[model samples]
Each structure stands twice: as structure tokens, then as C-alpha cells.
Target: MPRVSFAPPSLCLTFLPLLERLLPSLPPTVRDVDVPPLFREQFILSGYRPVDLSWRCYVLSLFQIHNETLSVWSHLLAAVYVLVRFLMFAVQQGGGILGVGLQGPEGQGFSVDVSSLPLVLYVFSAVTYLSCSAAVHLLHSEQTHHSLFFLEHVGVAVYQYGCALALCLYSSDTGWTQSMLGQIFLPVVAVVVWLSCIICCYADLHFHRPYLWHRRICQVVPMGVAYLLVISPVTHRLASHNWTNTSTLPLHFLQVALFLLSAVFFSCPVPECFSPGRYDIIGHSRQLFHILLSICTLVQQEALFEDFLWRRQALVREFGEERLLLACASFLGLTLCCVMTALVMKRRTHVQLLQEGR
Candidate 1:
């Protein structure tokens, strides 16, 4: 037998500090005053990561204490969970690009055909936005912040379109679907969503810290219009729904409430506003917004899934397969337009950065 040798305690102690030094350490964070103005958060005075860190350091910062840590992990984990759930659902239905059917209330079977395209698109959009948000939060540095911010705006535009597409196809009441608004809703929504992205990017580019009010207005107005337009179907559905049938009603209500509350937190910094630096590492408004929005998304998904199962046959027969494919194709076109807009804005941002000697 070979004798096993263990290092003595003294020898181990001597190497401990050296080993620690050899390993990558968490980068030191700075105060709001120390970093560039673009990196500072309103009412957040400390725990700001330095602007000029290597890509590896920023990736490592995910596990370290910083203002964006919670923001990053919150949406990152939500995206992963949603993706895993979708995969599991697909496996259960049938291991294919298109599943046969899903078991619904009381074990009723509903067909999954091209009619399922909207649901798939909505899930893809949700994952895209959530992943994009996480990436923006994780990799945001002075060098990449502008391009990433524009990317985030594009994600929002895509998500809005996704929600509109699903609600229009699946959740709208029969009466509403036949109404005038429904006839022209999707085309108008596509344009509005693109405009919202452009407005958001423009606001960020032109407005600095002092023009916060103008920036907020420019950002909020277009988004509010797009949101109202996209959510009209759901609003109409909820209002016209029979209260006696309480199956998916509660989920709709919960999703709406969560979304509204999240908007409040997103627009206004709370607990942190009251006491600066107190919530820098925890319990900030943005963190709350991310959590609430994620929950809202999950609830919305469940409600939509239930609605899809209940109305699949009617939807397919009424709209026909051609219309369904057309709607999806139109949405794809809108996605391309939004991506182009982001790229153009990103190029403009790079030019501006160079001009400013950044």
C-alpha cells in the first residue's frame, strides 16, 4: 500500500493566502459619485460596480454583492423556469415540434394544431424578453450599456407584439373578435409596438439625468399606448366574461393586478427613494418590479393556456388555417423591423460614444 501524505497545518496556512490571491476575487464596487453619470441609479448611492471591468469580472459579479445582482438573477431564473416548463409541457403532449393535444379541465382533450402557433410565439417572446433583461442587467458596463439598452427595448417591443398576437387569436371574446377594432387591431398594433421601441431608444439617447422627466414621458407614453392596444382583447374578455364561470377568471385578475402593481414600482422608486443606500443591495423597486412582472407573466400564461384549450376548435374553424399562418407571418415581419430599428440605434449610439470621447 502506498502511504498518503497530507500537508501540515502550518504549510497549508502558508499557502492559503497565496491560493486566495491566485483565485479571481470579486471586483470592488464604488459609490455613485465615483462612477460615470450614466452608471448611477436614482437614489441608489452605493454598491455600483465599476464601469471599466473586464467581461470576465462582470460575469463573476453575478455571485457578488452589487445593485444589479437581484435584478439579474430574478429574471434569469424566471426565464429558465419558464423554458423548462415549456419543454416539459411539450414532452407531455408529445415529443415533437407540434404536440397532438393537451389535457384540459376535467381531462378534456384539446387539439394542438397550427392554432397552437400563437401560444408558442408568446412563450418565445416571454423567454426572449426575460433573457434579454437578464443579459442587460448582468453585462451592463459603460462600454456595452447603450447597445444592450437598445436590445432591451427591442425585447419589449417583441413581447408586446407576442402578447397582442396571442390575445387577439385566443383570448378575445367572440363578439369582440367580430367587432371593428378586431378587424384592424393587429396591423395597427405592429406599427405602434415598433414606434414604442423607437421612442424608448430615442429618449434614452437624447435625455440625460437632468431631463429625467422628459425621458420618462417619452418612454411611458408610447409604451402606454402600445400596452392599451395590445391588452384591449384581454380587457374586453374580462369585462364581458360571465362571473358565474370562475375557472380561469381568478388567474386573469391576478395577472392584471400584478402587472399594474409592477408598473407602479417600475415608474417610481419606493423604499429606496425614502432612504437612499438602505435598499441598494436588496428590496429595491426594480427588483420588486422584476419579481411582480415575472409572476404576472406566469399567471397570464396559465390563463391563456386554459383559454386556448377551451376555444381551440372554435378558433380554428372560425379563423381557418390560412389566417392563423398569416397572423404569425405578420408578427415575424414586425420582429424583423424591430431588430433593424435596434441595430440602427445601436450604430448611432456607437457614433455618439466615439464623438464624446468615451
Candidate 2:
């Protein structure tokens, strides 16, 4: 056999670079330490991680290797799905994607009602929440994350109000907001409830170290209470509502249960905590929370749509969809104002750390 001589190292180096260019490439993966402190959870070992690289690199990182890849995609895709569905619904009625002023009972031969506009805003709020979640986890900017958390909780609170209004619309013989006063206490109580949630969520970020455990507990308490309070009233009257049968409660309960489960996963990072880095990539508590929350949103959406379709006759007979839309517009405005107000700015510790090049 003829002896084979290896190429010179320098010559080999030249060919290696060219060969690398010719071959299929993969985005680089990262270690946890290179990621944000928020992601430095216990046991998070070998998943894809985000680094504070350049802006272009950060955008490219979406498809690149990272632990939060699934989280970013799931929520982003969910927002897309909601937007698409809303657009489809709006297209048929000749309304814009926002679907403003386009309302009727759900079903074929869609009729128009001006009063039903507020439901459109509520849908917008839900979409806002999902979209913000995707943005926050994907970008992971300290300022944006903190601000987005405020936005996220506010979105959640607004969606809950929408949920209450939908349920109230179903339960009563009047339009959505008109009947909101006596039966649906959520609209009245929600201002306090959501504002409290926003504050706690803000504190969770703004106040770091010292009583870290205490801060976490404080976050959980508000969320836990909000979940309990919001779900109970919205779901309790589902079956007995004028538009729904006794049998519907089971399905409605499923929606509420999913929301509750999502809350549990959100508040208690159980299995992930137990296993640590084992579930850093997928099946993490946060990912689970995202999935459950999306499912709950869909479940409630379908039910409310159906409830509106059947219940529209009653509402149209009384106040009309236009009136309902107009009245709830104020409520939507209040929610937006409160959320914007709660989005308080604070000095970002993580950004400061990164600035020192640590």
C-alpha cells in the first residue's frame, strides 16, 4: 500500500474554511450562564440559551439553538393563530382585521350588530396578551421584559374582563355591558383585581434579592387569588345562563379547569423544580403554562361565540349589539388606561450587569 501523506496544517486550514462554507450550517447553541439571569434557574443545564449578542444575532437567534426556543415559538404561533382566526371572521363581514363594529349572533348568515363591538376589543386584548408573551420570552430584553410583564398581566386582566362580559352577555337577557352591573361583579371588581396583579408582577421584577422567596410568594398570591376569583364567577353561571343548557357547565368547567391548571403551573414550577436542568428545553413549567393557557383561551372563545350566537336574539330584542359595543368601549378604555398606568418604569439590574460586561 502506498503511504499517504497528510496535507500541511496551514494548507489544511485554508481548505477547512472553504469546506465549512460548502457544507450545511447550523445555528450555534449556548450555555446557560451566557443567558439572562432570569433564565438562571436551578438545574437548567443543557438546553438552548439566549445570549446578549448584537441585535441581528438576537433576531437570528429565534431559529438558532436556545432553551426558550419552544416557548418563543409556541406563543408566537398562538398569536398568529388568533390573528388569522379573527381576520377570517372579520373578512366575511366586510370589517377590518380588528373586526370592529362587526357583530351578530354566531352561525351562518351572519348579521351585523353595532353593539357587539366591545367583544371585538376583548378579542384584541386576548391577542395582545399572547403576542406580548411571545415577544417578552423571545427578545428577553430586561427593560422590555419588565415592561412586557406589566403589559402581559394587564392583557390577562383585560381578557378576564372580556371573559366576564361574554359570560354576562350569555347569562342576561340584555346586551353584554348593559347586564354587567348586577350579575357580573367582575367588571366592577376587575379594576382592583387586575391592578393588584399588575402591581405584584411588577414587584416581582423590580424587587430582586433580599426576600426573593417572599417576593415570589407575593407574586403567587395575587395570581392565585385572581385565578380563583375570575374563573369562579365567569364559569359558575355558564350552565344556568339563558343561552346555555345545564349540560354546558361540564364543558365550561373544563375551560375554567384548564385556566386553573395553567395558573398552578405558572405559580408552582413543580416538576421542573424537582428535576432541575433535566427539563430545561421542553416540558418545562412555563411551556406547560403557555400551552394550557392557550387551550383555555380557545375553549372559552368557542363557548362564548356559541353563547353569543344563540343569545344574540335576546340582546338584539333589548339593547341591540351597537349599544352593547358602545357601552363596553368605556370599560375597554378603562382597562387600557389602568394597564398603561401600571407599566411603571424602573432601573433594570440585569441590564446594568450586562453593561459591565460580566
User: lDDT: which candidate is best?
Assistant: 1
| Candidate models: Cα lDDT each | 0.86, 0.63
Name the lDDT value of residue 248 in candidate 1. 73
Question: Which stretches in model 1 have alpha-carbon errors above 4 Å?
Answer: 1-4, 7-23, 95-112
| Model 2 lDDT tens row, 308-345 | 55665567566565657655775667586656555443
- State each candidate's clash count: 0, 11
RMSD of 1: 5.1
Model 1, span 1-358: residue lDDT tens: 9998786789889998997666567768889999988888889999998887877778889898999999899888888888788777667756432434555668587664677788889899999999999999999987787789899999999999999998898788878998999999999999999999999999888887655688988987898899889989888877988856856777877887898899888889997999999999899999898989888888888887787778777877889988988998887999999999999888898898889997
What stretches of model 2 exceed 4 Å from their correct place?
1-27, 48-50, 89-112, 171-187, 209-211, 238-248, 316-326, 346-358
Local error of candidate 2 at residue 206 (angstroms): 3.4
